[model samples]
Structures are given as C-alpha cells and as structure tokens.
Target: MAVDKVFDAIVVGAGHNGLAAAVELASRGWKVCVLEAKSTAGGAVNTQELTLPGFRHDVCAMNLSSFAGSPFYARHKDALARHGLAFVPAEHCFASVFRDQSWLGVSADLDTTVQRIRAVSEKDAHAWQAMLADFQIKAPHLFAVLGAPMPSWKLARSAWRSWRELGKEGVAELLQLLLATPRDFLDRHFESESLKAMMAAWGLHVDFAPDTAGGALFPYLESMANQAFGMVIGQGGADTIITAMTGLLQELGGQLQLDAPVCRIEQDKGHAKAVVLADGRRLQARKAIIANLNPQLVFGRLLDAQSVPAKYQKKVDEFRPGLGTMMLHLALDSLPDWTAGAELQRFAYVHLAPDLAMMSRVYAEAASGLLPAEPVLVVGQPTALDPGRAPQGSHVLWVQVRVLPARVCGDALGRIAAGDWSQIKQDYAQRVLDVLEAYAPGLRGKILASLVMSPQDLEQFNPSLIGGDNLSGSHHLDQNFFFRPVASYSRYNTPVKGLYLCGASTWPGAGTGAGSGFMLATMLAA
Candidate 1:
C-alpha cells in the first residue's frame, strides 16, 4: 500500500474479464488491484430497476447459455455458488413467431423437438436429429477450437480431433458449415421456412445476417445447444454473476477501486510500467498490466501514439464495431398471453420475425445506416424461468431490437429525422412494441411501465460499448480467430513488455463467457 512499493499486477476495468483476471492472480497469492470507471462493477453485464420500482431488469446481458458452458464458470462454480449465485433453467428455451402467428422452437429433450419438426415436415425432423447427432460427435473439438487461444497447440489438436472423428467427407461438410451463410446452412438441412426461421433468429443475437458468412455456427450451436442443455438465466438478475465475482475477488485479497478511471498507461522504453489515474494518482504494476478493453481504447486512446507500432495502430484504427442494438424493458402486471398457446409462457425467449428474409432485410437496412421497416425482435420473458425478477403474479420482459445503425443516417419509413437516434428513440421503441403486439395480443395493455435504451443511451452508459456495440467489435471473418485485433498479438501478449489483453475484443469474441479472461489468466499464472 506504500507509494514506494509496486503491486504484483494492476487490472483496468472491472468487467467480468477483469474480475476474472484479478481472481486468478490473487488466488495464486499475488497482490492485485482492479480499477473501475463506474461506481460499481460488471460493465455491460448488470441489472437495474430501469422500468419501475421493484422491477429488476437486466441492463444488457440476460441469457447465460455461453456462460454455463464456459470453462471459467466450470472451474469457479463452487466459489460462485457459495457467493449467492443461482441459475434458473428453462426447458422450452427459445421460439420464433411468424407473421401468421405460427411458432417453432426447441425443447430440452431432442425427441420432443423432433416431434415438433415432424409437424412441419417429416424430412426436416430427420435432418434435425442428424444435426444434433453430428454435434454430439464433433462438440468437444468444436468447443475447443472456440475456447482456446488461437494459433496454439490446443486449437491445432482440437481441429485434428475434429478431422479424425468426422471422416474426410464429414470434415469437409463441417468446414462448409463454418463458411456458409445462415440461409445456405439452413437450406441444405431443412425444407420448412418456419424451421429455418426459428434457428436463423439465433444469428441476429450476434451481428450475423442470413447471408453473412461465418454465421452458420451461431444458429447451429443455438439450436443444438438448446436441445442439449436448454437456456439459463440468473435467479434474480444477470448481476448474480457479478455479485458472486466481486465476492470471489475480495475473498482472494484483490482490492477494487470504483470511479477510478485510468487516464493513460505509462510506458517505460516501450514496456507497460504503470497507470496514471484521472485523479493524478499513479499505480505501478511490478509483474504485468492487463486491459479488458476494445482495441481502440487500449491502443488508440489509452496509449501514447508514438509508443505503438504503425501496423498495430492501423489495425486498431480499422477495428469495426458491430451493428448497434436497442433494449426495451417492460414491467407488466401479468405474463404475455402468447397466441402460440400458453405453452410459450413456459419458454425463456420468443423471437418476433416471419422468416430468414425478414432477418436479412433488417440487417441490410441497418447496415445502410437506416432503421428497418420491420426489425427482428428478441423477446425475453425471464419471469417464465425466474419468477423472482418481478412482484408476485407480475412479470418483466427484455426485448432486444437488433440491426440498428451505430450512426443513424436514414429511416426506412422516412418519418424520423436522419442521424438522430436521440430525436426518435421513443418512437422507435413504440414501433418495436407494435411488432410485439402482433404476436401477443393485448400485450400493450399488460404493461405497467416501460424503459427504452437507445443506441446512444447504451454508449453513454458504458463508453466501452462504443457506438452501442455490445459485442465490443464485429466478429466478421476478417476480424475473428487468429486475425482478431491483429494476427500478431492474438495470443493475448502485446508488443509492450508485460502487457496483455482480454475481453470481448480478444479471442472467443463477445458474449458473457470469460474465455479470453480465463485463458490469459492461465497463461500469466503459469
């Protein structure tokens, strides 16, 4: 604690990844300090009473499918659980509602889902089962390839195993799955638009569109994984993970300073040496400096321009944020009386879209910096899974309006003014609600209160969500895996001595999963 002595390490940002890094380092008896710009931690993964008093809504992240399967959670489950983290599971995980009001979704049991597919097409039912079977065979390797640090033995061995398990022909098919568009992938497997639409809805969760290459994996994993393990939400809110992480960090002797934003990373001969705080305080790290930030922030804003290499600076400058999103939180007196039968009330999420074309149209329109005529909506009724989120007999809904422009330039309807999200966000939220009303009649009447967060609002709340991009940066083919940030430092190490990077901007980009964090922690700890 003395000014004369340096700490073992210092972490900037108290997001899940930063917290994970602190936990790993502190557990090894290293003295650690974590600085957070916000008053509290959990950056984008937070919960708040945004709509009304007593109605707790997840600020951004809600689903925990990736977190449930993440290696970080696996190793820290006991500690997290002991610190008051509880997850509620949903058997009927997700569904897609069409214009005709018909819906298709997955169930906890594969046989149950196969039966539902049979109702649409018996051939599609068989194909659905085949995909699940192949996933079971190739899952271990596929997950390894995703979770491990790129260009490492772990990734190399995982791919090799996949090639071995799937014969040459099967491996070729798997490669095609990786490269194909979501529409192409679906068309190759199923005949029913309803079935394809249900799975393709998963692509919108990320920035991927129907025709976007490297998008097939999201829909494939979403459908097959839901059938395998279903979806999970925290008991009370998404911050249950945050609460538990903070407790774990504190217990491991890591100190956290809130509202202490780092002004710059002080470099000594091109080596990361210390951090200068906005308040003019200096914290020196004896061992390493880890930043859980997007590449733009870490290299573009936080470091001296002259200190970074030209190529690295260019790569960071070119880092593209994904399409923006709008979040709608509603406090209702009762659950949505879904027309798809009350069975939908038992599911976790219901997506509002007619088919893959609708999803594509929205993406195209948004990519053009215009609001769409009809945006794909992800309607989450977590109260169906965790009743503790609202007062007794009442419910809360989390709606994500996908494929909005980061910088609005036009409106599909030509009603709203151009490039002014702040000017028309409320009207936009209403349009989204109107879409919801089409699928769930009388949904407008059930609302006691509502909260709308525009893309600008999201970025304002967390500057790291630059331009309202929740995924940190785009996961397109050119910027993913080994090519992420840049191919040179994809292993988490930086050109600066004793500097590392982790978070959604790093490997295993996006999601609440702490892959990059845990991976970097493991490497540094070793």
Candidate 2:
C-alpha cells in the first residue's frame, strides 16, 4: 500500500489506550491514523484459540477492573454496549487459601467480606469494616486524584481541602495508610495469620514488594472499590473492550494499519515529524504523535538519542520494569465438581498464598532472579461468568503466578521455548494444580488441554511489555506521579515537541488504562 496523505495525528501502537486517543481526537474533527506492530488491534488485550478448536482464551488480561473506571468506558458506554460488550461481576472478588487449608473469600458485598473476616478473627472483622467506612468517606476525593493528571493545582487544592475537612488526625491516619506495607497494616489490624495473608496478597497484583517504600494496603482496598463500582468482563472476554474502542475509532473516521512495526520516530526541527515503519514506509502527521509503548522502548529504541533530554534519558535507564508473570490457560472437558458450588461460581477468584511471611519470601525470591520456593497463584474462571467463551458443557480457567523473576542472567527464554521451564514453571504449575485439585478434586481430570505463556512469550508478543513487565513501569514511590516515565515529561508530553505518551507507562503506572489516552486527549484538545 502506498503511503497515505498526512493525518492530523498518528498514534503508534493500537493498544486500547492508543485507540482511545485516536477515537477522542477523531471525534473532535482531527483526521487520525493508528499504526500497530501486531496483526491484531488490541496489544495485550487479545483473545485466541490457544487451547482447543472452539475455546476462546483471553491471551493476556482477563480483568476489566482498571479500564472500568476509565473515561473511555463512561463517555462511550453506548458505543461499547453496541459492540457486544458486557460485564459479569464475580460473586466473591477473590479467595485466598492458606497452607493450613484455611481460606478467606473476599466478597463483592462489603458486609459479606467482613463476615468472612469474622470467621477468622472477630476483631479483624470489625477493623475491616472500619477501614472500608473510612475509605468510603474519602473515596470521592481519592477517585478524583486517580481520574486526573497528578501534581495538578486542582489535586493539591483537593488534598488541602480534604485535610481541612477530615482534621489533622484523620489526615495523619490516611497518610499512614498510604505509606504502610500491606503486611504491616494487616498485621496491625488482624491477629489471624491466614486473614493477614489473604488481605496482603492483593498488594502483589502490582509489581511491588509488600514492604517496598510508599507501599500500602489501601491500593488493594482501592482496587476492590473500583471493581465494586463497575468491574465487568467484556461480553466476549477482555478483548471486547479493545474491539469496542477500535470500532469507535473507525466509526469516527480514524484509520488503523496493523502489522506495521514502527522502527523509529522521525524528528525534524526539534519536533516529532513522522514514524518510520519496518517496511521503510514513512507515515507523516501534522499535529502530533502519541506512543502507547513502554518508556524504555519509546526513548531507548524509537526516539533518536539527541531528541531526548539527558536527565530524562538517565531516569528511563534507571526506571525498573515491575514484576514478571507466568500464565496458564486451560480448556477443561467438564466443570470441576466443588462443594462450594456445582456451577463455576463467580466467587472463584482463588489465591494460593499461604501467609504474610510466605508472601514476603515469594517477592524476595522473585527479586533475586530465582523462582519463589512456594509462589502465589491467582486463578479466574471467566467461563463460569460467561459460558459463551467455551464449547457447551466445557469451561476455561485463567491462572496467573505473579512476581516471577525474569530469567535474565541465563538463556531462560531459549530454555523455556525449548519446553524446559527451568523447573520454575513446572513446580509452580503443579503447585497451582494441587491447590485446584484439593479445592475441586476432579479438576485435574477435567483438563482437556492447556497452554503456558512464559514471561518470554509476553515480551515476544508485545515488545512494549519489556521482560514481561506488564505495568509498563514500576509503581514505586520514586517512579510514580511527577517521576512517572520521567519527572520532566510527566504530563504525557515529551521533551520532543508534539510527541506524547499514551500507555500504562505513564502516571498511575499499571493495570488500569487510565492515564495515557485521556491525559493526552485533554492536553491536545486544549
């Protein structure tokens, strides 16, 4: 195909956020074009038949919680709904199983979650309710902070007003909640080790140590609140959200070119001029260029060295990629019979973290480039919530083991590709299966087929996920807010004029596709 005419804007990477930016800009009368390296539009939000002929497995992300609170969902609900988008809430958000065979199920209902806690520790149950109550009081303000760009005058003013409204003591308590680690906070509130472990495991969802600085248990609570309000699965799976965004972009006259890997972002007169595709096609843009990729790939590989500010370059080099994950997608011939429920219950967000000490050890091992002796596994059976995902009477199970170390030192990728999982994947997968078998005994026999995607597979599939670091960048205190991606370019705008970032790598870090697209849209529209 010949190079098209210049577009008002060119979005590199057709991820959800990229498509979102294109849709917003195009809706405002800007001629937009989206370029994707992959064959499909959704970057990580892909669905494929990896397990069986008819089973539709969500390749990467399964939860739509992060995207739920996004402006993309709110502003375009009708369009999304028209594209077959649907959400099914999990009965219990998650269940944490301990080594002693005890478990805690975190329900969607706040009172039910507290009751689950009460089954373990009565005092802790009351404490959980108090925590929820306190957070509810401040949830609106917190949501405002998350919704908008950070370091804004508005955010500061809101913070000041909150301080005044809540009083000095309340402000102090809130600060403590933000700074304390999940383990510390849970230990202080709950006496039972299982209860503490159950709550603390939520912290691991992001790529941070439980004891990492500026770590807090509030992140877990905040995520739960976000889910409670509207964490629905896209009708056909997670990819449905991405498909809706893409459809909207197309409807608004935006163009999308897939299988076009961008090799470099061309610049002229200190401004972004165009992007050079691997096929030697230079697609030019008139107004701006947005990158929906990780900072390392965007700065280190895409942009020329001279175009980036020296300080920003240094920070990009130092910015750590968060945790790595190993995912197992299974196609079961029949549903696993469980005492909890005969039909796969939405309450089956299962966790295999034994205790706080064990969870801590898991992180320590992952950081040291060694697989955890006993890893934590999180499982979700979306097929239970939506049966259309698989063949009749069959099911699909999505299992993920977070905080796995990227086998960087050795030829781990080669070994894994060669079917040798370095004993890590083997041991971890078996452990997860053992947990499943015990809870749902016939689960092992019901497995018709399974596919495992190592961290290497993630990187290969989406180069933006450097070393399988899904968050784009770490969510550590040093890398968040003003320091996100880099301090000088925190507002989605880069030092290179007219070039902006619209991906998970920007502020708010990962999981939620909140910051990049909306921030870029607001800035460009202004």
Candidate 3:
C-alpha cells in the first residue's frame, strides 16, 4: 500500500462494526481501508488463550447469538460461512443459583422450562408460558423499533407499523412495558424470587440494574429470545466472525491495516479529509472517514478543537460511560460440580446473582465508587456446548464481574484498602471465586491457570471501552435510544461533514448485533 493512498473511505478502527461497515461499502463498489490499533481485529469480539494454549477464551464477548441473528449476518451468512465461520449451539440458555443452593434455568424445550419454574411456583409456570406466547406477538414489533435507525423515517415507519399491528390498546400496553423497571416488570409476571433473578441477570449484561428504568426490555428480549432460539457461540472462539468478516473484506478489495493507530482526524474547514497515524503516516479518504470508536475519543481526541464545534465537544465530554466490568478467564481441569445441580454444567451461563435486592446493592455500590462486596458474576461455561474451545476434558471459564466502579474509592466489604486496580485486582478476583464457590463447591481446585482483566486492563486493550464499559456508554433511558452519544447525532453523522461515528457509542447501543454499522452503511451507500 502506498503511503499517500486515497481510498473512498477510511475506517478508523477494525472492530466488528468497523469491519461490517468496510465490508458493506466495499461490496457496493467503494474502495475502503480499515485501520486497527491492536494487532488483532474484532475489538470486544476477540478470542485469545489468556489462560493457556488450547484453552481459547473470549476475552470480552462470549455469546454470538446476537451476531448470528443480526441483519449483517443475515445478508452475508453464506460468504461468512465460506470464510470458516461456524457456531456451536446450546439447548440450555442460562441459569441462576440462589443462596439456598437452589437454581432456576431456562431451556429451549418449553416443557422442561415449565417444570423447573413449577418447582418454585406453579402460578409462575403458567406466567412463563403466557409470556412466551406473548413474546411471539411482541418480538416483531419490538425488533422493528430496535432495528430501525434512531429518529429516522424508518423508525417512524416502524412505529406506525406497530400501531397498525398492535392497535391503540396494545401500543399503550407496550409503552408501559418499555418504561417499567426490571423489578416492576418481574413482579407483575412471576412470583419466584429465584426465577426473577434468573431473568434479571440479562439486564446487567448492559448497564441496567434491577431498578434502572428501560431495564425491562433486555431481560424480556434475552429471556424470550433464548427460549425461542436457544443460544449459539462461535465454534472455536468468538473471533471466528471477525476473521470471516476481514477475509471477506479483503476478497472484496478492502484493505485492513493492523497496528496502524490513528493519532488524529485531519480536517479542512469542518470536512474530515484524512487520518494521521501515530507514526505520522497520513492516509487520505476520498469520500468519508468513519470512526468506530468511543464518542469521547472521536470528539475529544481525534478531531482537532477548531474542527469540532464547542457545543458538540461539550456533548461528547458529558457522555457517561457505563459501570466497568472485570473479566476472569480460567483454564479449568473440568467444569464445576454445582451444588444446585449438575445440570448447570449444561447451560451456557450460570449467574451468581441471588436476587433483585443483591442486584440493586451491587449497582449502588459500583455507582458510588465502592468496590462491591459481592459482585454479580456471569459464569460462562462454553465448553459445555463446544469442546473444541479447549483440549478434550478441559474447560475454559469466562467469568465477567459486572457493575464495578471505573475508579475505585473504597471497598464495600472493607477487605481491601487499596483503591487502585493494579494493587487490588487479584484480591477482587478471589472475592469473585468465593462467590462462585458458594454455588459450585471445590470450584477453585479445578483451576489450572487464570487470567484477570481489570477495568483498566480492558480499556488499555481497547480504548473504545472507556473505563472498561463493554457497552461503550451507559444505556440508561436518558443516554440511550435517540439520545445516545448525542441527542441530534444519533444517525452516525457528526458535526464534521464527512466524518461519521459507528460502533457501540452510536444508537441501538451495545452488544454484537452490528446494527449501528449495518445501518450506517445502508445510509451512506444509498
């Protein structure tokens, strides 16, 4: 590649969204170049053997269900599959172990799930069936609202279609459901505290705690979707999709430059022209420059002060990152023998969040800059469904501790005096292990090797995860929907004429859905 090569578009980051955007444009006859700072692509979708060789762990994301069902995958599934993409399905979706040594899990088989629910509350069993039936009617409407561009005509059309299909009364009911908190929503539907806790764990996957408004949607969507579609992970690792996408991009005449860190976006009179690399190499963009980055970096660091408007800069500065998440990857001799039940080993994720009250406490503690005494752990047992992720009989544990402070101030349990993550990550990792040990006895003994990634470590690895917020920015009602990143700039376009933003920071927010990238491509290509 020539030093002064001018492509039709230059993608700033080679995250999944950036790759999706680059591939989409290249397929439409646009010459694209994707520059990634990291040696590897995929960003949060990356997979690495952090624990040991042959023990492949998804460094950030584990589940690929959202990516599998995304519009981008739907459009290019054949190509991706041809490029060595595959998935391993798990019939058992997720489960939660209670302090009472009891657990509740959701399975693809409706009867199996109902039986588990009936063990706790027969009434809740009936409620579970009703919600699944209701989900059939609501999923399409809800997906329409979520799939369309925020604050666009497509979005208005989706709302109108929902009105026509759901009618006035149905639409009113849907609005109430969207505004309700997880606790409130669960209270109306289920009686078993354990059952509610099992479903509510899905909310914490983003930034929503039990009481967070607009939190009900994720719990409802994930629970119902998992029951309907089951869950699927990459065949070997989560990076399969990334590898496939990049391969397809190259085949389509798109260029990917790894370890090419963009220092800043060069602009001329409010028009983004090129990106200057950290090594002082400039690659010009003939038409557009798309930044798949945190909004703060795109505005606060990349674009020069004179190029960005003062008001726009203020909005980016005020953008709130979600509570940080810590990653714990372990190469285990075998899966834990759960005290709740051995059946837990069959599920993809086992959440160690006993109840809604605990969820609320964890959120409050992290929000107050205090290290949570008992952090909610999302224990991902990928080997249960995909043995190829590790050597035969061995397993990899992907434990994500959610809702930790970005910058610690104090310890909720008063056990650790150090506030810095460097000094306290190991101590905090042990606390998470203790939490798991309560549900899965002798869990610690199975560990052959372990790798702990603090919030700081994640941010250093990938800058988009500012403060290690995997969702990139908070998904609260005020910061999400049409108000994401900025109120008026929800459609990927920025104040600069040819510079656009994509990735987790844009509307439709986090997860591996690739909605922001695909949507942005459609707009630009049109």
Local distance difference test scores for all models: 0.87, 0.75, 0.92
Model 2: per-residue Cα lDDT over 281-385, one tens digit each:
888889999998887788878986667888878887887888788888999986666545443355446677767677788788778776565667777777777
Q: Which candidate, 1 or 3, would have the higher lDDT against the true structure?
A: 3
By lDDT, who's the top model here? 3
TM-score of 2: 0.92
Off by over 4 Å in 1: 1-5
Model 1 agreement with the true structure over 33-97: per-residue lDDT tens digits: 98998898998889999888889999899997788788889998999999998889888999887
Comparison by TM-score, 1 against 2, better one:
1
Tens digits of per-residue lDDT for model 3, 414-473: 988857888999999999999988888898999999999999999998888989899999
Please provide TM-scores, in order, for all candidate models, with all chains considered together: 0.97, 0.92, 0.98
- What is the descending lDDT order? 3, 1, 2
Ten-residue region with minimum lDDT total, candidate 2: 410-419
In Å, residue 208's CA in model 2 sits off its true spot by: 2.4
Better of 2 and 3 by lDDT: 3
Question: Would you list the clashing residue pairs of candidate 2?
Answer: 86-235
Candidate 2 at residue 175, lDDT?
70
